[model samples]
Target: MVENKASAPGKGSLLQQTRLVCGLTLFTFVFFHFLNHALGNISLSAMNWGQDIRYVVSGKRLFPWIFYTAMILHSGLGLWKLAQRRTLKMPVWEATQIILALLIPYVLIKHIFVTRGAGELYGSNISYQHELTALWPNDALWQSALLIVVWSHGCIGLHYWLRIKRWYRRVQTPLLGVAITLPLLALTGWISAARRLELSGNQKLNVTAEQKSNLLEIVSQVQLGVYALIALVLLTLVTKYALGMFQQRISVTYLDQKTVKSVPGPTLLEISRMKGVPHMSICGGRARCSTCRTLILSGEASLSGPSKTEAQVLKRIGASANVRLACQIRPMTDIVVRPLMGHGKKMQAPGLSDRYRWGVEQPVVVMFIDLRGFTSLSEGKLPFDIVFILNRYVDGVVKTVNRNNGMVDKIMGDGVMALFAVESDMSSGARDALACIQAVSKELEKVNEDLAAHLAAPLRIAIGLHGGTAILGRIGLDGQSGVASGLTALGDVVNVASRLEGVAKEENVLAAVSMDLITAAGITPAQNLTERSVAIRGRSGPISVICLDETAIVLADFKPAS
Candidate 1:
């Protein structure tokens, strides 16, 4: 079975944690800076007032050191990550983020040197007015692009980091609105402030020729130093790549007997991408999503033990000891493996909304309906006739479920499984399930009449309904061109519901509705209905259910309790 792991708290690597903290610190700084710039929507003095508060908060003694440290660490870690990447091929968002990040230092170094460097070295009091005037009409476009690039890169980082969180998915839409609005407002405020300064005829900063020359010389040196640092990082990566060619190579044999040889350092995922092999990595091999999990068929001893993060993910998915995240393990020896989730087809697009994709636990109403004696009815029938009748029955059931705000999860031969309340509350879901059962009975009557000549006897269906918390998610591989095959619910609730259908069939009743579902739906059981506690298979205890032979009696008479 393919296992999709949910996010869980794990003992993360120190490097990962440190990078996260540093990135958050830098993002915080940028957030406040944007807010300060947004003050330009008011007056020039308002922007200055905001800047003064910023100075007290982040521009002061220790705060400045913290900010600078975070900036350096964040940049260094980013470069380190780039150098560590075994293959450059990645999702568009990941690639875009890296490219934007690379551009940041180049675009931002001059601005930083001109503002903070000037203030520290020459005691220059640079305000919004001074900066806006210096940048407007000439360098404004570059600065605007800089704002967008920095904000986009930061937002992308935050997205990947936080998208694993369940709550983050719920609020991402509004957060997206804010993400887009803030930078635009900052730019508008900046233009407004700049225009105000232009009108006032005060665009130049007071500075001596020597100070100007000295600042320019320092800025040029800093820019060249940044360029040199970037070139050095590239050289290091190229050197590593060149050296890897001469290193002892290890082979990975896939289940299809396709073998790929790679240097010992790169993870299985990196190897797959390098060799143009399709692999699933929904979280971009970050170990947050376990789609890239593989079962070690042999040579497990040659692979390293799972990292804390990998262990946490594997445990969450309830994977066996042999299962490991392909993105995390770098095998030192030849190994044969089978990817748990099928290759490229299973890889969900990164940053895809999790509303219906990711597994989430919620209260749901599950219903299972199976046609009684379907095998007996089809015994003497031709294949075409059997298919025609089955399709008619399934079509009717599907329509009935849809009309009652329920989703038909699956159909296996003559059985139909459906879920309710996936997009609604539990109460409504329970009501929908009950209503669906009632409608299905009537719909089945029409099917019986339509195929009476072909039927041995009028068709009869047994239905079971139960309500509980279950994991709801889209399962099964994608169809052609990445169309979802189906959404399904998993857990004890679904199992119980299926078992209850068997009870209904054995008791010869139209439906067996669990008391849990009845109570949740606020429906009062009818006096004539059969009430009993039946032990479900695979479960220890008996569950109370109300069985009804006639759908009209209870369905029409019962009213939902307020």
Candidate 2:
């Protein structure tokens, strides 16, 4: 069920490669960061290699500037994108990612200033061990924070990429298990370093009593600052949540403009619920339900990618790379999307694309064929039997209409509304009208033969054909499709054709008539000997119509003007 849209450069296109690159870049950064942190526990030497690599880039003097510049630009661009969308209604996983992203810069600044700048400018001579000893109690908070951010963000991006590849679901969990377990190992290594520092008290060098006291005070102040910062961030989050409750909760708008607005910090399901959108959140937004799916139309770069939950579910659904659960995508920017099911809806809210608009032309013939005595057949038959017969009859009629280049626009029980393209020069509307009548009569005759005596006798059909410049357009209820007409039909041509077919039941004939335009278009009745004036509905005077019966009308009946 994949739909391919034209991807050539156009005014409104869905593809944007830069976003993909940005997302990939961020994910790569996180993955490497976590892998290095995890290595610290293996041995001080392994940790040294990780630091050596960082030093190669961050301390290269000439290249360090370039590295710093790139990081600033990439991180800035990612943050700027996240800020543009005014809505805060993101899934829980996404909201957490954004919070962690904001914290990363601040946390990393302390790290850089202490290790690199403090040692260079103040002559503190801070090695990784020196900094750990000075920081005291050797708390692993920074280590834990950094590890969580790197693993979660990296795995999310990987999950998203894997979803698009074949067999993503089959191996996603085992892969996820590795991603999760590695970080825990890294955390354990950091904890081990803290324990070793306690055991090796001799590692600390002699210092004055005053110097030691001052260091303890400095560490206490920094710890207090960190806790205060965490408290403030929590307060801000609570305030945002409360405000979201009062205002129309943040909603995500799709390319279709169908909104999924819900509580300020809604799970994907809640958002879908608030907006009356049909989202298949099979896992209940627990990342367990891959059914609440979405294909990101934009801002994929700003996203952190699928979380562990999303990855598992996407694997279950066998989704494409771009496809993800609605629960998984917490856009920091506006996105356009087409729900696989809701693409062709009627009366879509503003800015939503209604691709279902069928642009039919005017001055065409409209024909309606009703089966006589179909009601009686339904009265005695079972529901299934009635549907079976109805389907058979409708299929036969639809095939007949389509064979002649006419559209079987709608079917109501045993009735069918077919439209012939008046703008088409290949065939005249009159000829199409006549062909429709012949096709229906012929199809019913075949059906009567096959059914023999089991059917409700032989079905009789009455066809009403109206040919004029009729507006052939959709006539449907709200959010549905239908076929209908407007009033102006050059004279009573359509009315007469309809009335003529009405008399068909009594006359026991399948009849067709020609209008001035039909005749002008090279379509003439088989026997257009005379025009008889007949009274028609909604007209003040009698209308003259050309009647064609019994004989087959040929294209020769109409001749080109010399």
Candidate 3:
């Protein structure tokens, strides 16, 4: 099939985008709701202003449907995701919030149904006063549950958004304190109003005919709304599943080693859409799911930091520095980032070995080994057979190196370089070198055993061990630095080890050694050898070289490499 080069907008990509947009809209509604509720304790007039604001909001014909649609999509997608997962292993508070969210439609159904439906039916608009009066004496347990869940969900989303910023950590405690305290204040006010009403005799008085009719009207409207949401929710469920099936996509980035892709004039959501990558913005691209997260490894200047929604979500997730929601960033220049977790192929976890595992300031031991006769062996075998043999040989060598606290660096045509103590706290380079040599010898025996049935002759490996001070930093081109730069050793020690490996191959010995500097630093070779003066390639005159005896294999014939 001819690949379609023209990148069209993907299926259900718009649904994901709509979900994000709606989620953001909902978050905005949440902010507005709380801000209005917060106004109540200050003054009744301030609370009345909330009615005016609601009037303006309701005046927009699109507002109600937009919000309702968002609620359905958000709830439906969340339900599907929850169902798909094997376990809901979230924190306790988070789990509670999820339960609360599940209960919200029921809790809220009464309010929306009664007020909006009654206003539409009886033509008697229910004002804030009418709504407030219902809860004046005290909120029901379910109402309180609604408030807690709604507020907690909003706060958790906000916290996750903020946690991505480096500065967010600094004020996280204070922010959390405020988030917790304000909700308590809202609940307290509701309880106080409820207590005062409970003490009053107004509710106990005989209800007028009009008031009784209004109450029935409100009750019936709520029932209607509940049925409506249930039907729409089911419709949404079927639609989401139907749409999701055709919405498969893959995301890609042209990020370099120290960068993430940045796009101009596009929200991260739009970019992902354009790039054909599958992402979740369950709250719409409103920074709620945080599934659209990316790490700005190198191009921070190119991208904007977290918006309010993103800021809040990051805090909840406790995301580290350098992380940001793609939806939040609008970079003018190119940036590179792996989507923290999403539908794109799991790109290899970058920088796990480079930046996080090893630092340059640490002391490390460097070892270089070249398998002698590897080139000649390759010449005699088929291309596939050569690869097979070389791979087995390299695998054995690398496993041994790793067992000794060394990371195998680049494996050349016939040689491999590795380092030890790069990640160690106590500088175990010398010990690591000793272990690597023994490992190589032991692994070689296994390789020989396996090769005995395949090849005409046994393969021999020559390893040169050296230890001392080195930068032990990642080294490569400007970009693509981490692919092979995990644990590099710089300084004279590395150079000497390479030279010594050459000497080992030339000397026809299983091992070759270095100068007194290495010996002084406590790097003992596997075998005893005579110190000989030899003219080195780069050095001035004859340099002292410790040569290990070729017969050292007899001493270590018992132990397996593993």
Please write out the lDDT profile of model 1 over residues 1-562, one tens digit for every residue.
1112233533246677788899899999899999999999898899999989988866566777798899889888878877887777777888999889888876687777667777788888787766886578788888989999999999998987776554576478899999999999999988888888899898876455687678778878887887788888888878878999999988888887489888888888888888777776667777867768888998898888998889888897889999999899988889888887654343444315453455666678899999999898899788999999999999999999999999989989999999987767677788888888778888989999999998979999999889987877777645446566578999999988998999989999989989889888777776666679989888999999888776453466566665
TM-score of 2: 0.37
lDDT of 2: 0.54
What's every prediction's RMSD, in angstroms? Answer: 5.7, 19.0, 18.8
Best by TM-score: 1
Error of 1 at 281 (Å): 1.5
Ranking by TM-score: 1, 2, 3
> TM-score of each candidate?
0.75, 0.37, 0.37
Query: How well is each residue in 71-156 modelled by candidate 2, as lDDT tens digits?
Result: 55555554544533334554444567567666665455555445554544455655546545543354357746866775676565
What's the C-alpha lDDT at position 330 in model 1? 87
CA error at residue 55 for candidate 3, angstroms: 3.8
Better of 2 and 3 by lDDT: 3
Candidate 1 error regions (>4 Å): 1-12, 28-69, 116-126, 162-182, 202-218, 344-364, 369-405, 411-416, 421-463, 467-477, 481-484, 501-534, 544-562
Question: What are the lDDT figures for the candidates, one per model?
Answer: 0.81, 0.54, 0.59
TM-score of model 1 (CA atoms): 0.75
Deviation in angstroms for 377 in model 1? Answer: 12
